[model samples]
Target: SQTIHQWPATLVQPVGSPLSLECTVEGTSNPNLYWYRQAAGRGLQLLFYSVGIGQISSEVPQNLSASRPQDRQFILSSKKLLLSDSGFYLCAWTENYEQYFGPGTRLTVT
Candidate 1:
């Protein structure tokens, strides 16, 4: 029974400001974690992924970065956000090849 959680369900920040979004998993250990961004009515784009603690891989080139400080904690951070960064950010985990997603965070860059 694993559950993923993401905070700050909605965010509004100005361009060039810093951003931090957190995601954590409960009842699961060493699960493959992933970060994705989805534009309105569009498909999700993979951002980052972790196979284990301290091991992160980028799926695409972007202005953001990710870290896995603990076995169940994954973080997404950016020193400066851009207008194109605004979207719905999602945190997900894979179990037995099935993916489970969190409630998601909606970011609006002004």
Candidate 2:
């Protein structure tokens, strides 16, 4: 069985602070990982996805970036935050085209 993990279930940050979001998958190997966002009144959107260590893809022009440091760990980062960047963040791991998502992180920027 595989499980996904995400840290800091909720966050409240100022508009200019740095941000780091982490997600890890257990019971799997070299799984494709992804970071997704769901803002208020909007649909879920893919922020980044990774097929392997050091391989990442970004889907949006927002201030967020992602990296895969290990085979099963993915991270999302930001140097400067914005109010519009606040949203519900999700981490997912895929196997055989099925995506299993971890509990999301709720970020609020003010």
Candidate 3:
């Protein structure tokens, strides 16, 4: 069975602060990892994706960045958070077109 974990279910930060959110998967190997952000009343927008270590594809150019340093670990970071960056952050893995999502992290930037 494959499962994903994300930490700090919710977050509150001031603008221009650094951000770091982590996601990890268990019971799978070399799975496609993806980061998505959902704004209020909007569909999810892809932030980044990775097929393997050090391989990442950015779907949007924003204050967010992603990295995959291990087979099951993925990280999302921002050097300076922005007010527009406030939203629900989700980490997901895909087995073909079927995707499983983590609980998600809600961020509020003021």
* lDDT string, candidate 2, 22-58, tens digits: 9999999989999999999898999999999999998
Alpha-carbon local distance difference test for all models: 0.97, 0.93, 0.96
lDDT of 1 at 14: 100
Clashes of each: 0, 0, 0
Candidate 3's TM-score reads: 0.98
User: What tens-digit string does per-residue lDDT give for candidate 1 at 72-98?
Assistant: 999999999999999999999999899
Q: Per-candidate TM vs. native?
A: 0.98, 0.97, 0.98
lDDT of predicted model 3: 0.96
Task: Locate the minimum summed-lDDT window of 10 residues in model 2.
Answer: 92-101
In model 1, where is the ten-residue run with the lowest total lDDT? 1-10
Order of models, best TM-score first: 1, 3, 2
The digit string of per-residue lDDT tens for model 3 on 2-57 reads 99999879999999999999999999999999999999999999999999999999
After superposing candidate 1 on the true structure, give the runs of residues whose Cα lies further than 4 Å from its correct spot.
Answer: none
lDDT of 2 at 98: 85
Candidate No. with top lDDT: 1
